[model samples]
Target: MLNIKYDIVGSFLRPSQIKTARAQYANGEISLAELRAVEDEAISDLVEKEAAHGLKFVTDGEFRRRWWHLDWLKEFDGFTTEHLDIERGGVINHIELGYITGKIFYDPDRSHPEIEAYDFLHKEAGKYPGITAKKCISGPNMILVDNYLQLGIKEVPYYGSDVEGLIEDIAIAYQNAIKDLYAHGCRYLQIDDTSWTYMIDEKFLQKVASLGYKKEEVLDWFQRVSTKALEGRPEDMVIATHFCKGNFKGNPLFSGFYDTVAPIISRIPYDGFFVEYDDERSGSFEPWAVLKGSDATFVAGLISTKNPELESLEDLKRRYAEAKAVVGDNIALSPQCGFASVEEGNCIDEETQWKKIDLLVSCKDFI
Candidate 1:
């Protein structure tokens, strides 16, 4: 069984030096090797810090990439990254979205760069005996929403309106990727996903309707695609899914209770779920009742990551109490999302970020 008490949702605030190195590399002022050297140093320090804090699992802080999803997708075949202005939380933000260009395939050799990333994490984590290295990758649902759905059926003629075929290919590619990660000695993997949260938004539903699709039909597609992707993962591998409601700047993309998606989400085969429960925007814990009798654990994100304000311990306990009342005792604690979902990081200082994690750890046994 996974013995996770207090865990992180991956992605920590990027250090200033690492951010500078990335900017310098992007502007051609520094070589890729120089940038990677700086990243390695930063990630090493971050891992040591998390291990020292007693976190059982640690990430590389996603220091080597910009957006969490695009960075992983760029490694796959048939996906190309492009800059676009996306509106999030009523503001326009320039971000990279991976577009589908040709047939999709997850080439292990091409994915070795990340496998090596995990190698570094595993090596660093080795310095702390009790902790394990965890690698977070974007889920197949991202590909469905960003490339296939957003691009439309006509634009990516390779897919040719064959939604089922598209889902199958994505799932197969993901399965191959998962097996490769396990081969590289990665035992803990979290598939970070945000597309599923959009199902609760009326505007998103209207958009789907305009495309001749029903919301339930699209959700059903996500379920099948997500499940198929987990098909051949090793039984020993601890897999978790994080449901993000979009973290950009300090704002959210969509918000609603988990009511709409719970029936479908409850059936996901992941060992645990890291769910967003930070603010009023995320709605109530009532929907999580569906997981009451299942083996799945709910890592309730009762703390916020978008800002620096530390959540009070009493309030945190109260939130867990409410969720536990619905889902029983298979509960865990984490921030609503990653401290930094992108390179910019959240509008919080490093000291404050650690304090938030300290709070989570202190409250591990509260539920």
Candidate 2:
């Protein structure tokens, strides 16, 4: 029974101070304590700013981490990351996580490392009575692809040829993590995923085939794992999933609509969806026909986060009009994605980023 009309995808452009502090910490010039102190102050200021802008939920701006997903990935026990410098857009190259190595599992009684950040965020958000603090984590399916399936690596010496069983362990881990998070007072959680978006793109679909994964089977796998992850959560806990098509230096790795994957996405048990609809690259609202009548809400990402250029309000209204025509009142609005999926951020200043958020908030008046 949670509702929010205007929201964000749970990240903001990292401030210069945070970028500098992280670099200093990496170079051994600063202590972990020093870096965390800087993060605390930046997050405190960020929550206040988000509240002032009329945001119903606030994040730490994801300022304390490097890549949003990798930070959380490392928190789990059985995963190790290798750095692989990958070419993105040919002009901008950055580190991409190589295939993760290890078996994934979780003891249900164990505490999540991320709980500390939520503790801090919950306290900070309490300062603003009506605003909820949101925690965004990488979903189970994304973890499977990022760690094993995409790289064609099998879980060796342990559960080899048992991919389905491995998926069960991942979902159980996700459930344990969610339960722990709710215990720590988190009411809003977003599972950031890119795997579902990959399925809709033709090129990535070919890649999936090349990797020995059938598109239909993988889609069903993603749905089952995602649903299992949300099991046994508190009735009041609000969980949503953000479907992202690779966001690096403001360039999308794939371009396509949700036509092929709509049926599966529509059935995810999460309370809501934060879907990308920024431009034609995301295709038309034809998928809404399938998404209609679901109990879940839809946060149409009509606003763009890839660049600083403001979207024409007229264009957004026109698109929303089409979407609403299909889904009716189950729809809400947000940016297509986070301002920065990683620490480097989109090619926009913090001011431009805030303005993008302001645009989302103000557009609610006319919509």
Give each model a TM-score: 0.95, 0.95
TM-score of 2: 0.95
Q: lDDT tens digits, residues 1-367, model 2?
A: 2387889998888887898999999999999899999999999999999999989889988887778787776766566567766655565465656343456665546655578888999999999988899999988787777755556676543557787877787788788788888888988999898888878888877878887778889888899998888889888899988986888767787778788887787777878888998877877777767757767887899888896789988888888888888876778899999988888888888888888899899887866
What stretches of model 2 exceed 4 Å from their correct place?
98-100, 107-111, 155-157
> Clash pairs of candidate 2?
none
For all candidates, the clash counts are 0, 0
Query: What RMSD, rounded to one decimal, does every model reach?
Result: 1.7, 1.7
- In model 1, which residue pairs have backbone atoms overlapping below 3 Å? none
What lDDT does candidate 1 reach at residue 106? 88
